[model samples]
Target: MLSGMKVGKNFWNGAEWYLTSWRSADDPSPGPYRRALDTSGLPDNIVWEGDAKTYRAGPWNGRWFSGIPEVLTYTNVMEYEMVISPRETTYSYITKPGGPLTYIVLLDTGVVRRLVWDADARAWQTYFQGPRDVCDTYRKCGAFGLCDAGAASTSFCGCLRGFSPASPAAWDSRDTSGGCRRNVKLDCGGDGATTDGFLLLRAVKLPDAHNVSVDRSTTLEECRARCLANCSCLAYAAADIRDGDVRSGCAMWTDEIVDVRYVDHGQDLYLRLAKSELPPPSSPQAFPTAPVVGGSVAVVVVIVLVLVLIVIRRRRGSTISGKLQPCLSLLSFFFFFSSFQFLRLLITAAYANIHSTLDVPGARSCALSFPCIEHQLSPAHSVTSSSAPAPIVPYVDLLTLREATGYFSESNIIGRGGFGVVYEGRIPDGRKVAVKRIIQSPLLDEGGEAFMREVEVMSKLKHGNLVQLLSYCKDGNERILVYEYMKNKSLDLYIFGEDPKLRDLLNWERRLEIIRGVAKGVAYLHGLNEEVIHRDLKPSNILLDDNWKPKIADFGTAKLFVVDQTNPTLVQTAGYTAPEYITERYLTLKCDVYSFGVMLLEIVSGRKNRNTPTLLSDAWESWNQHRITELLDSAVAQPEPELLFELDRCVQIGLLCVQQSPNDRPTICAVVTMLNNSSSQIRAPKRLVFDAMTEPRLREADHSAKEGASSTSNGSHTIYLS
Candidate 1:
């Protein structure tokens, strides 16, 4: 069918129209394959092979087909429209003016192809084709099965978390058609306090829409609660993702979820599972299994040794004050063991010290004498110094890090932050890396704890826009973190630095891209199973790669909020700190939103908010005065006429983010939608709490408050700005 053509049914006339394939290449008769619109529940395009279904284009989720997230990349070339009413239900698309001419055709093989006219090549070229991959086959992974075409495993199908193959024998032979069954039965018939929770599956296509319930009025949290209350509800997701971070509307599955697969830019699905199947809460203070096991073994060994000693003493006829002698012997044994351990540590330290002083290349002399002394130390010994769990990331040796960064040379330094100095380095394998060395302080233990916290936080997060933590080092008193290096440095360099060449590189388009990238990263953090609030979200913390793509960095101050945990340790930068955080000592995901808004404004204006004491007030004034154009960065050319509306919209969105009350601010999700879709309506932002007074005055008052009280009367933590 050509663009704008429709294949649907007319309810009033009871007439239906659909596309049918030819019998064969040479035959004109209708074939077995037919493409039709299925409106039984959610509307989807289905390719039927006579009596059986072969392929599905997934349901429409406002912006694009749930299974065709790639459509977002080509939105500029065409506009899709869907109509659902009593009269008819139809779907069509119109090519944009001056864009490629496109048409879709159903082949006798049951494959659908979207072809576009290539004027330069003077031939029709394939724009898209489906089933595009093995995963696109209808129910290829069966019910409740997830299909991942890019999975490293030989098999493309696997059961979801908390579930197992229903027919293990069949799956053993490479047949997963039977799908999977829940490992633990869900608690449904309880006193309304059932121990059932959700397992969040991120960036995945929503499941089949059949046997689904949707409510547009309810929020995602409400939907979750409602689904938890229903015995049959199996999964839930946001029906409409266009709303800001506080996503509204609900789509719940009451029956088997089918045709699920991973896709880039896809929506999140919350699959119900028994609480026992859910992952344990992540905590930096959690104890490691190795230490506990080692401790138990050590205790048994000590008890056995004491008993042996007591028997020997009794056999020797040393009966005078027997109990006191045994106690003294036990104490003496502990002292001797501790001294032996101390001596071993001292020897290892001395060898390491000698090794450092030597200039010998590829030396094994020290290793021959001390061979694996530190490595042989048990976890029990390590736990005596610190109870923190072992980090998930690999541990790099201190010597290796030293060689990578030129013995921690001053010439290799890349950047510095509150926690430590970052140095540019290349690993032995030729991979460039950024090494953050946390400077040792008198509070040595606190520094080590913070280092572990950052490592733990970054290890759990895996996203394109967040910097990747590759490894860490905890040799002696040194604590260092190694991350994937970003060549473009940080966003602050381009937007707020003194270099004109650097400032010119970030035009409105790049700034917009960076803004959107940061928003998506923050949204991902906030949407995590255990929501994370990036206590620090300034531009300096945002690093840019060669392509100028932004990656959120400096997660040392990030805080994970578990259930009922609202108060975060007060950590703030002067200008970006949210008013609610400063004045009321309250914190939430909204704090990051507020900081993002300030950064957004800074990107647009090319001026630091801290330097420009009235940046917020000025933006609000300029917006109201209809001179918002004046706020645009003068370092670059003015935005094109077409982009003027977007420029103004961003300014307005930023103002909305920095609203006086946290409740009034839009969620990061909403901010993303607003930034991406210019048509999305945005309410006027409330005036700033310090609209009458400049930032300097506010800072002065904050200083006074800090000196007056250590904490607020309501038991909330006091804010501390650096």
Candidate 2:
């Protein structure tokens, strides 16, 4: 049933007809070849074989089959009509006040029978049946071919006034599958314009209409003229099948004709033939005729593009040098595509309005990072636009992310922290990166405050040992901060791993390098006149690169050790937190120094200070006993007295920084200079009393958890102690 059609039991609606197959054998279940009123195309009843064209009732015109001298009786009992438009098509029938309801059905095979129940017979009586014999084979004669069901003992097939058998042998054997062959092939010279003509095929089931066009607006004369204008047109049918079924205009077919059947009720299919082969058209009678939305052509095109980009990213994302780059891109596309568009429009419009002296890399091209003008379309890693390194760093945008972790996708997730996750990202095309995304809330005021402080600090603080903050974003609540990715990750990877040889990655020489690098970063942070202190420093926070350079990260919990200021005290983790700060809320640069000392000890001994085992405790106790060699990492295996002295000095410094007094320990700068100068004299730290090392005193070290600090995705967050 096409779109809109009145349905009822006597009418045998689509549902009723469809369900008949489930009825019992005695119940007279209808067959599978579905029969329904095809309100579309001219409007007639058509039987279909699961989307395959089986047969059709050529539409009703005002008169008879136009070919079959019948259907004039149609008005005697009922009124039938059809309406066609670009939007939809429908065929409807209504009978007089006391008239009977009518319906059509396809039998077990392909036979079409129009049945009108007889009150006298007490059974369904067929009013009409079509294509009853072999001669009724649909479109047996093919395009321009006609069939007569009443032929005497022989298949009645003949050409419509024109056209010849496409295959002569097949025709002799009665294999009409040869269809109707053209007498002459079209000569569509180079010129697109050409002339064509049509032979009227009547009383036909029409041709295989898989490909055809219908137009009801034109007259029969106009239809002929239009057919003549196109060289490729193969056939045409009445625009409306209701009139004479003669076809008001023409349903044109430019493709091969198929599925033609002889029907008592069929329409004229005007088949195009060579001008020389067509009979003169004195009269207009032509027997015969002729995303469904979201992902339409346009939407499909975008999805295709998105898939292509994702593929490219996957390939490039897995590169060892840039693991997370591709993954980041997918993530960005999923979450930030729309946000990016808005941001892009914002930047595109703002480009000309702003002026600054800072020589940003490809400045003019830097619209929120897309940098249309300066944007370099890199085919690979090398041969980027020729330009010296620019000193200016602009605010980071989503595109900069693509250049970073390749775009922060799955392959780029270097590590998953308790809070947010860590992604290996890149900055611009050449820079490698680590992007850390925070997965917690921002209502605590810590996120924004810490972020701004980081940018302001990273903006001016430059040191080889500190992780560099490339940029930040507040897309929705999606807070992302990008930094340079360290190739070797952090110290815990090598020191805590089961592989004894893993420590080889951090040999004594590399360890010293990391120590110095960390000292330098700490020194740089403390050097700020405003004084920035890393309140939550730990070994994991210290990342190591391929060159064994140490860079400190995770500033979410860092505190500003202002020279003279006071508010929301009790900063820093208990274990690495300075004793004075933990006991008295005395935040200072010395707090970080203490944490750094603890980290240095971990690096040297391969043991966590807070979870010290008997070996560690005994080793430290033996340190003062001059048994330092016993305290060296088992992975290190062997150590010289000089290395022992170095470890001892670091341990002493760490213990000194953790002293119960705020004024005793060295500042970050002093510690850096102290650790760097080989010949410089450094005071040995005073050992604490027995009570300090007792179990009871060490049990109260859950300040961070007790204070309920909002853990960041990176396992870093500030603990507010009001």
Candidate 3:
């Protein structure tokens, strides 16, 4: 199609216009592939091959197609328009005046391409193309399956979180048509509050909307409520994302979701799941003992039979009645003696094998040694171990960890802090991992209970924004943790480092996404059954994945604080510590909120808050003086005019979080709500004053007096004062 041409249908006249591909490169005959406009439920461009759908350009979502996020890059070269009315519907595009010529074409292979004339090159350059990758194939992953072209697995299809393959055999055979099924069935029949919750899947193309319910008048929260009220609703998403923080309009899906895949700059889809399946399951119960007991019994019986055979052979010649009684007595005596000795040997072997398998010292009890049965009975290994359950957290051997990290070479170190040092390593399975070796200190003690506590806490907590704890090691005096490696490292490198190029990469939209992600993570921590307070929340603790998604890290200083519990502890970083935590030694959920507030302002300004009055005072003054724009990082390009309001709102929220009194600051949950809902009113923040020199000097003196006190060169240091 040319730049100024239109292709669509006129309902009143019963006339239509579309494009068809040639039968061959040299032949002009119409082929099986055709490109046409589809207005069934939403306006979109679809490609068909012999009446079978092949590809779908996602529905028009205000600025661009929902699936084709690349359209934003081409806004300067051309403009697209889609019109829908009772009389007619059409789609067209026009190149900018005095710009190079541009046009689109459909190939016989069912691929679509847009070309632009290049004056210097003397040829047409391909500006964009569709059916771009494997993920673009129609229903590539089947129903409820998410397709990721960049996944490390050989197959590009995987079931969504909280779901399992409907047909495991089919999935193993590289067939994903069976899709997935919920791990825990939803409970929609509750009398009061429903037990169903939604899992948010971010940066994904919305599923096929042919059977969806679209209401442009309702807000996202209203959409969520409506979906929760109706049992048939399966998922929901925002119909539009044009506004900065106020995403209006609702799109609800009642049928099985299909054709969902990851895309750049995509929207979020919340899938309804049972509450029971939301949290990670507790560590698996101790290994079953039935297998061990049964194996030992079988061995004892075998020994008894062998002893009887030996006794019979030795007394074979004594057939007389007088000798028969003596032979029988000898057999009985041998059977009992052999059984006892064999049982002792079995237990000894079991103990040794268990220690080797688990890499734990002093595991002398036979009850926890079931894993050794397979090694003892090599012939019946498969039969003896088929029913055994896997351990939730596997124990890594010191030798394996040493090899992974090149014997703790200095070059392999990724980060170092008060707790320990983190090294980047690749395990035997060819998966990249971050290995943290705990520093030997008196605080952990010889029992290593502190290490276990950290592992237990991390194992139970599961969220997309939280760094996942893969496995751990506790051998002798060594304590280590393994985590999924993040390619982009931490937020501090980009926002507060010396590289201007990296700082500029974080545009306003990306920064907003990071802020929202961190907020959700903190809210999750506070909303847990036993609330958690991250005494140290800073830019250095927020790690970014390959996609730049933020994941909260460094849980060494985190603590589980139940409601009304006053477990006062002094463990915090310099700048991110709350006022009450520092002066009164009081730790609460609000303390984390305060730390988050400080980090939020630091993120916007791209500056560290290590100095007492620099960041907080500057932010407060900027808000009151109506110079919020001046607070933005100079490295970042100015945001669009439409985003200025959101930039100002972020500064106001930051101020509210840093109020002198903990009660005055909003809860982390409330902070998340404020960030998402632009309509929510924000109250003015209370004034906070810092005795600049007094606080810094006091902190330094306190550190010198305390034993085992160490700090990093950067002000982001952790202080552990008991």
Candidate 4:
């Protein structure tokens, strides 16, 4: 409230002293700049004119800033506390008994004042004034200094007893903040260990305290002992200095100290320094007494690593999966081998600096660097080593997975899917695995139960293209579903030019194989007895395995419909969506057929519909315009001529599935039968006709762009009738 900077009406949670004068009675644009308690030193409120520190309320005593005479009156209106000790000294105001006219705020403008509302007068009145003079510029002195603007010296800068300005030239120029430096560097915790000491400064502000460890129950002596023992522990203090006595609590610091100032009342801070960094001692000093210390440095590090590894290893194995370790391990091996091969080529004979030259025995050959996380997690089984094709999610005991992943860490995230993310984890025996995370995001579903549908549906169905659900966590708001990590991730990478080799790897044979796998998966979803329609299907949803097999994943939005039963409204996606569903809201197995047909064409063409001139138009042009080759992804070569025939057949099926009239499309059974047929030449589909009753302008506007831009559209429907 005191800074005079306004927070907006909407975001403000009404703390009156700031911006608002109690309520919104005043113009809140901007008030004069003013600042309050800076705890970097003995706590006090100081008003300023930009560069000049104008007012001083003095340092905080255990009860109040000693210089604030108004605080004595402050007791009449409200009981406020001004505290000082070691960890920090602070100044704050709160209401007390019978104290309705309360508010001690730093006023806007360069004035330091306390305000009290006169309820009867219906106005606020200021009772306290600060910055009586120009002597309050903090750190007015240069490095190694103290500021007493009232000083009689010709030069304002004064070096402390033993320290000097870091740059005497700069000191003359009045450059501070780069205060002082010890002429002799301290022999810090380098080498073995060294002696150090603390010099006490009385009634002064403590330096910045960041690495503080506080203990309320500990006494002053106990606090000192704690700091002396650890090489890193620098200072200690009793947080609250009260009634002219130190009270409970301790705070310790470990780094360089900066910015100390004092008021009429302030804290006593004990600082740490190496013996060399300290002043010449008046009396011989004993190494400050330390608490009992145990264990070698290495031993402690190893013990800590052991405990951390135990916890993290388990979680990593379970959540993100330890694929990172395996991945790194794999990379490390390649680097190692590549280096060795280069060395063998470069050196006369097998090199002699084997051990000394960063090379180890048997490491030069094709030896595993670090065992893959899979080997570490489970020695008996590869995370992906199911005798039968691995389930989308393997059925493993919870304990086993827990033992594998070191409990998911930042390093575990490998990939993500619509339903969840994939994490690399490791198992106990050191096997690495990937874990899929079904995240809970507000944008996808608001209520917790909406995600439960996926569990219910996936629990009963299994198919190759369908990503298998490994396990689910329903214990809390966590509606997490785990699945087998598909090593190659999704087909998007291969199809999208994100990875060039990806396309080449999936040659004609593999591409056709992926098509069939997907067809079968979507076919299963549309079967008679257990009809499941995948409402969302795309390249991102299709995951590829280590062997490049495509698996349809993320059935969270999938709908299970039965034969003869149909949805009355929109369910499937557009483009891939059956025309009947988008235009008139009628859904059938043909809906999934339509979607599957889109996916089939996508796999063969290695192109996305959203990126095309138009999926249907592209298909039509490819069929008749001699640009058939352009339809296939440029990254991948043409599939076998026989396979090209299958691609053509599938493309035709896709068109039939997307016909404007649902009745015009063949049943899924007939389509699959034709797909399964080895000798049958699928019948060509009739070009769909648009309704003519609609006004030409509306029809043209409503018509998809892909249809308009690629061709003139002046001729009759170009049907390839058989």
lDDT of 2 by residue, 461-570 (tens): 45566777666765545566777778889777887677888876677656766776687677656654556667778877888877777888875333332223464453
How does each model score on TM-score?
A: 0.45, 0.39, 0.45, 0.37
Model 3 global lDDT (CA atoms, 0 to 1): 0.71
Evaluation by lDDT, superior candidate among 1 and 4: 1
Q: Write the per-residue lDDT of candidate 3 for residues 1-722, one digit (tens) a residue.
A: 99878777788888988889988767889988999887655557888898777888786665566787766766776777766677666778777778788889997767787767768545565555567556677877788888764332246688876788999999999788789887887777744257777766655677887757877778989999988888888888887666655687888888888888766556678888887655332111122345456556766776676676667766775455465666567666766766676676567555543443122111111223231121221222221233653334678999999999999889999988666899999999999999988777655547766567657666666677888889899999888889999999989999987889999888887888798778877776776655666677888889999988899986543442221236555467777777766665777889888888989999999878885357788887787645678899999998753355566777778888888788889988778755653323455565556423345765666556453444533001111112
User: How would you order the candidates by lDDT, starting with the best?
Assistant: 1, 3, 2, 4
Candidate 1 segments whose C-alpha is farther than 4 A from its true place: 1-391, 441-450, 557-571, 691-693, 702-722
What lDDT score is found at residue 605 in candidate 4? 78
Best by lDDT: 1
lDDT of 4 by residue, 366-470 (tens): 112221111111221222234653333334455455444545555677766444566676655454556655555443444545445546556656566667665
Preferred candidate (TM-score higher): 1 or 4: 1
Off by more than 4 A, model 3: 1-391, 556-567, 691-694, 697-722
Q: Please provide, for model 1 over 216-249, each residue's C-alpha lDDT reduced to its tens digit, 9 standing for 90 to 100.
A: 6788889999999999899998876544355667
Task: Name the regions of candidate 2 deviating beyond 4 angstroms.
Answer: 1-393, 398-411, 416-419, 426-431, 442-450, 556-566, 569-574, 613-620, 689-722
